[model samples]
Target: MSFKVWMMEIRVPYLLLPIILSIVGGALALYHGSFDVVNFFLFMAVLLLLHITVNTLNDYYDHKTGIDFHTKRTMFNGGTGILQKGLLEPQQVYRAAMGCFIIAAVIGAYVVYRVGLILLPLLILGMIFALFYTQIFARNMLGEISAGLGLGVLPIIGAFMVHGLPLTIDCVILSVAAGILTFNLLLLNEFPDVDADVPGGRRNIVISLGTKKAAKLYSLLTFSVYGILLIFTLMGVLPPLCLIGLATLPIAFKAASLSFTEPNVGDSFFQGQKANVQMILVTQLFVAVGIVASLLLI
Candidate 1:
């Protein structure tokens, strides 16, 4: 296949957004003199690569498990552009996913070399979790917990690798807060996919809790993230202005209310997917703004 064909099949451009956001977050943390620039950049690169690899793998597996078949017609969003669109064979998609994972492993190995053997196990576990998230095993049972640990704790490990031991409690708190925010994003995204996911045997939290309860869970997590920030500020850990994240509360509340009233109201999978994506992007923007404000004001 031509390069353009492959790119189109994988939706590679859309993948850049998350990679860029992650790099921005990591860079912002470093800009505040949190760690060595070189090491921080390397860590960011590793994460961005891993995230892209996971996205690719998800596309491949969603197709492998027949999730993409009905996605084209129903209220289900399709991934693995190749499989969904019939541009590439299943084996080809699988091979491409493995290639991305291999590249991520190389980057991870370097991180281990720079840090210590302690991070190796975490790295291996993370890779496995990434693969199994939508692949061979549906650990969707532990989705929230895994999301928190993988997104929150793992990034903090990356930060510490560059900064070294005797880690700052402040960073840890920020990391946990960031992780919670990330987890909520994932949770919200799953809302629209509940229908297709249930039939496909992908029963995640949304499937287990049902749409109404899951919507409430999303709302609770959204508010709780800012609430935790406020509490931290009261305790003098986070800056008071970090509560600027509350600025996005109106948007979040609107999304939550809509989600609760019409959990799966979109006309099609694409529309539903768009709604969930909007929530996640808006929340991330608020969190990013909050992070910047905290760094400056605190």
Candidate 2:
């Protein structure tokens, strides 16, 4: 397959999550006065590969199961349209996904050698999630949970620990905020796919809760992201500057409002999805920057 085709298969825009997650994790490390440049880069490399594996493997499985064919594709939720368009063979995508998983494992091994076995569990969990997410987890109600833990909470915590910093309450609080944001990301994206997913035997949040209830849940969790940050900051669990993450609240509120008022297939829905994405990225980024700023100011 051409490199362009491969990039499309892997869904490059989603790769930004890994980069931002890495920064959040690394920033947590920096906040605690531990900075290891080598370990940080290694951690980032692993995040990127794991993200690619998730994208490619999900595409491969979705194509095989006819999910992609039925899915109403969107910039936010649907699998990359590469395989359905016959741009890449399913086997090619699967093999590439496996290749990424293997490479990420090897790098994770080296990091484990240097850091300790503490990270091995997260690495294994991430690989499992990447492989089984589409085939198994999404079919059950566990898809959102798996995505949040495997991609969000676990990776951020692993990023923090890779710098040889001990996990603390502050690190965990930040990781949970990341996880909730991720959970909302996957949950909201599922809105457009409910009809497609039911035929595919998927039982994700939107499908199980129905769209309106799920929309309320999404709005609740979206607000909770900032709620947790605010509560923790006031309780002295997080730095005061972490409140900077709330700067994205307007975008988040707009997204939530649209979720309640707009149909899932309309332009407003797409706008809401875009706003959610913007909020997710910038909130995490602002929190990370706040951590660094706190460190510098201290």
Candidate 3:
């Protein structure tokens, strides 16, 4: 397969979310005085690989189940568009996904060996989420939960555990922010896929809760995440410097408004959709920056 096509199907840009999450994890570890440069590299390697694995497998399954065929393909919602265009055969994509999964598994084994048995459940949960998310989890509400855990809580916990950091209230609060933001990432992005996904037996929050209700839920959850962060900061659980993350609220507020007023990603509402796509990235990066800054300045 072509490197260009492979990278496109892998959705390299989307992978940045996971990287940001891992950075938050690493930042949390640093806050606890447990950051290790070597462990950080290893943790990132597994995280990046697992993320690519999920993307590849999701593309393969979507194509196999005919979801991609009916999808109104967008840059964000539809499957990578590579399979639908015939750039790569189904078998090729499947094999690529499996190969990446094998590599991730190897690194996961290394992580388990290094971090001890406490991390085994997280590793296993991640594998299940990557492999069966579209087939099984997407149909139920489990999909978003899996995404939140895989993309959020697990990474921070794994990163912290690798450094042998003791869990603390501040750490849990930071990890909760990661989970909430990541959950919203999937929640907003799913709006465009409601039609295609439904036929494929996927019922995301957008479909189950209805667009209007989901929109309200999205707004509430967005504010709730920031509220919790602010509460912790004010209570002295998080460093006072972490209040800088609140600066992301304007962007998030826009995203919430877009979700409420324009829930679709068609040409008419594309700009709103753009805000939806960026909300998680901006919020998570700002939070990670605040956490890391607290590490250095506190």
Candidate 4:
């Protein structure tokens, strides 16, 4: 396949979400132990493959459902334009997704052997969610939570686990924050597709709850992320330097406020979609940076 076709099919840009999550995991690990560059990159490859699997499979499923056909898509909210344009056959997309999944599984198995079975739950959960997401979770108001936990929380925990140490309170606490940021990522992005998703049989949180309530839920979830960080910092669970995460509050607020104030869906909420994506990515980036900064200070 050509580079553009691969990029469009795999939705490579969205890989940023998993990339940042891996950073959050690796950085939090550094606070307790020395960095393992080889192990870190190995896990990164596994993550990228899993991310590719999900993106490809999601597009295949969405295309089959005709949702991608009817949706007014933007850069961030739509299925990768690959299938919609007939750039690749549906079977090609499905096969590619399976190929990515097998590669990630082999790598994950290797990591499990090297590290222990501690990562098994995360590995299993991530795969299950990736495979079934478009068919089941996307219809059960679970797309947002699944995205957060799979892309956000599990990666952080898995990142920390590969170092072969027992998980720390700080690791768990930080992972939750990372997960919440990821949840917001999908939560806000869903608004633009609610119309298409509803008709396509996707009962995503936005479609199931109505954008207004989903918007409020977005606010609550976004606010809770910072709230967790601040509380943990005050309790001495997180490093003082991690307060740097709070530096992102203004942008996050703008994202949350846009979700509720703008109140539209199916492409009309494009600005809100942008704000929400910014909030999700920027907040997690800062949180990971905060963890790494503490390591640097020492």
Top of the candidates by lDDT: 2
The C-alpha lDDT values of all candidates are: 0.62, 0.88, 0.80, 0.81
List clash counts for every candidate, in order.
1, 0, 0, 0
Flag clash pairs in model 4.
none
Name the top TM-score candidate.
Answer: 2
Candidate 3 lDDT score relative to the true structure: 0.80
Per-residue C-alpha lDDT of model 2 across residues 1-298, encoded as one tens digit per residue: 6888877788889999989999999988988889899999998999899889888988887787788888778888778999889887888888899999999989989999999998888888888987788888988899999999988899889999999988899889988999999999999898887777888788888887888999999999999999999999999889779989999999999999888755554588888989999999999999999989988668
What is the alpha-carbon lDDT of model 1 when measured against the actual structure? 0.62
Weakest 10 consecutive residues of candidate 2 by summed lDDT: 257-266
Indicate the residue-level lDDT of 91 in model 3: 90
lDDT of 4 by residue, 1-298 (tens): 6888988888877888878877877887778775777778778888899999888888999999899987767787778778778789999989999999999999998888888888888899998888887888888878888887888788888888887768889888878877887777888777778778888998877777887898889899889988998999889898767788788788777777777755343434676667667767777788778877777766
Q: Kindly report the root-mean-square deviation of model 1 from the true structure over all alpha carbons.
A: 3.5
User: Candidates ranked by lDDT, best first?
Assistant: 2, 4, 3, 1
Q: Which stretches of candidate 4 lie over 4 Å from their true place?
A: 261-268, 296-298
The worst-scoring run of ten residues by lDDT in candidate 1 lies at 72-81
- List the RMSD of every prediction in angstroms: 3.5, 1.1, 1.7, 1.8
Residue 68 CA displacement from its true place in model 2, Å: 1.1
Ten-residue stretch with the least lDDT total in model 4: 261-270
